[model samples]
Target: MKNNILNSLKNKFEQTKTEEKQIQQYFSTFDFASNEISESDRMFLVEKEQILIKQGKVNSDSLYQICITLLEVSDRFKNNGERKFMKWYEHIGLNKDRVSELLKRAHLYINYPEKKNLISSLPTQSVKILTKKDIELKEVQKILELGYTAVMDIKNNITNLNDDEKIKMKSFKYFDVKSIQKIQKDIKKMDSKEIFNAKKEIEIYKKLLKEAEKQLEEKEKDYDNQNNLKLLEAE
Candidate 1:
């Protein structure tokens, strides 16, 4: 019975592999960008995209490929291509948000081919978190080590925190003394005008820092008062 089950699973895997190959072959030959491409041909691609989406595990690479194709097809449409794309995308019964995300992932895949291995290996949500506008490449590599759920949780927690808490959480990273020193050290390379601009910027930053410190002190005092009230209540 176990052998029978194993053989059945093997057959199903083979069938999927065959289907993927045939669809990919079709994709390669089809002039999806041609203005003359029929509605039936467009629907064929849509059907294939739906099949991939409905799979138990949609591979990141396949999803990105389909997104790229869909966008390309949309561009090929002479009139209201974007509108047509949206109509087809909705017809596939996918979330518009999800479509936006997949397109972003696909663009990231194209733009950062060096990081393609890392991006393609992660789930869509993890990719979304890692590719945030403010997340640098080093941070992406570090969080990639934590795996999908951890990356998502870390970003979600950061997002959910209050402004003060967010600032506190990222304070260490934001205040990289070494980076500051590097900028200071590079000041020697600046010409007079550049140096003047840098000095002005430094003054502005100093004022900002002083304001932040004052606000922090106020918050700390409020926190202490809250703690004291809690202690009195307990008493």
Candidate 2:
């Protein structure tokens, strides 16, 4: 009986491994950006994107493929214009902002196909920030070396600081009340650009705080209901 169970488990594990390999192969070879776009190819890309979204487990490689697929079809969706591709992405369960980000990254990757491995090595947020405008490969490397806080500073138009100052900015927690108060006290010392960036950070924090409060309130309600059900069951 033990031998039979062991063989069954081994077979299942192998099967799963094989399936993963096949999926990876498919993504690798898929003609995601073919010039000769046919209806079947279009549908294939759409189905793959839908599956990726449904699985809710998108890593960097899969995300890169998704961007390529969207960038390809986007041209045909809105009178064959990529600029108007925003409406169709909503149908595929992506918000406008997310679709824009993916498209920008795709454009950057397509423009510099040689740097794909380097691009893929970075975080998705970092990639999004890097691709917001026309940037050189060397510039991307420089910003990456400076680290996350520096990248965020660039995102907010805080460009006057040196590398050390940019790196030091990461020490403060964006959502900490005490940190915000300290920043407030030091606001008078900041340049105009730094002031603008700080205000933007505060605005983002306020939005996040509201979202966290909402989620917490919902969880508390769920906890209370679960407790009430337990009390009734114990009666």
Candidate 3:
């Protein structure tokens, strides 16, 4: 029964027009295979930190929430700053573990700060440290290159596919022909700005698909209800 209620709520939320738009926007920007973050991207991190500092020292709740938001946004781009943020967080007197956990829930990475003082106090040395800028950029470049290769492989297979195969491919609508076409176009252009735009567009499409699925589920439920009512009347 609890599951049913939860499912119902999910269906309703998904069916809403606003939810549909939000989902479309989300998928349009989806870049699942991109590099998380590099050291060169430190400017982004610095900007975020500045925002936190500007927020002024408030009650513990507000401070923690803002920190979590900054951490969450950074993590979404694969630039997890939980450890560094936590170092500063503890310096200001917050629940280190709870804040760390919350950041994880928001899809950020978890690590212990590299500060010798923090390390000495920690129970374990196995904790991963944040990657430096150069290391991070290299990692990003490698991941992007690998993503390009995968896209190429999929493109080759897709081109060879017959009508039956193409129809079967609809099961993975997120990677449909249109998406592949855009990807190929971006590759040909070989511009970082264009690639970023293309990636954002793909994310939007995925969000739209999610919204459409939700709407379809709601319609299915309504249809089921009408059929059930008719059957009861006939009986």
Candidate 4:
């Protein structure tokens, strides 16, 4: 029984590996951006990015090179900060705050020099964990229209607010941490069956989303061609 279970797991793992390779190959040859060469170039750049991330995982030398490249690129387009080096990450997304944090992390490693091994081994997504459990009530009022970034950013500044308000914010944050930790612990404890079901649900959701996109494209293909649509942004 144990041998059978191990074999089953190994087969699943190999299947997942095959799927990932298939995805990468499909994207490599896919004409996702045949219309705009710039978009096609972006795909290759992102592929290099994934390779850098995988390399950075095992080798400190690899990480140091990545950090150096990122920091240099950031500085090269110093004036065009957001426009040049912005990509979305969940929770904090790729906003000004995340950019600031990336620069700060890169500089810390650069200045320390010796800490490159430790810093590089550390996952960048770990930085996104620097979030409060809940936004302060006053912060809730101020950050309403802002997107997910606002959801992550809670103001701790007690400038104009009273002592009672400060205490309230602190208490809320304390509770938030405790609640989030408990939820994460519960999630980690889910059984294999539970985890499998969750993953199956996700696969179903992804297939449905792709089907919807396909249907929409089919329906609008003529309309889009006729309209030659371009979205305008107002300064």
lDDT tens digits by residue: candidate 3, 123-188: 111111112222243332332233322222322333333455325555774455665766777698
Among all candidates shown, the one with the greatest TM-score: 2
Worst 10 residues of 2 by lDDT: 223-232
Task: Assess candidate 2 and give its TM-score to the true structure.
Answer: 0.36
Please provide, for model 2 over 11-122, each residue's C-alpha lDDT reduced to its tens digit, 9 standing for 90 to 100.
9999889967766654434565676768787777766765774354334455567668878887667475544566555444566655666677787668666655455444
**Candidate 1, which ten residues in sequence have the lowest lDDT sum?**
223-232
Q: What is the lDDT of residue 80 in candidate 1?
A: 56
Which scores higher on lDDT, 1 or 2? 2
Arranged by lDDT with the best first, the candidates are 2, 1, 4, 3
Better of 2 and 4 by lDDT: 2
| Top candidate when judged by lDDT against the true structure | 2
Q: Is candidate 1 or candidate 4 better by lDDT?
A: 1
Residue clash pairs of candidate 2:
none
Candidate ranking (TM-score, best to worst): 2, 1, 4, 3
Q: Please provide the root mean square deviation of candidate 2 (C-alpha atoms, Å).
A: 19.5
Give all TM-scores, in the order shown.
Answer: 0.34, 0.36, 0.26, 0.27
Give the runs in model 3 whose Cα sits over 4 Å from its true position. Answer: 1-179
Q: Write the per-residue lDDT of candidate 4 for residues 1-235, one digit (tens) a residue.
A: 9999999999999988986785576434444566565865777766876676556544566435544665787777668654545542222233455345455556646655654555443333322322222424344233322321211132333234445634453567323455445546767888988878767866886688567645654554444222212101110
The TM-score measured for candidate 1 stands at: 0.34
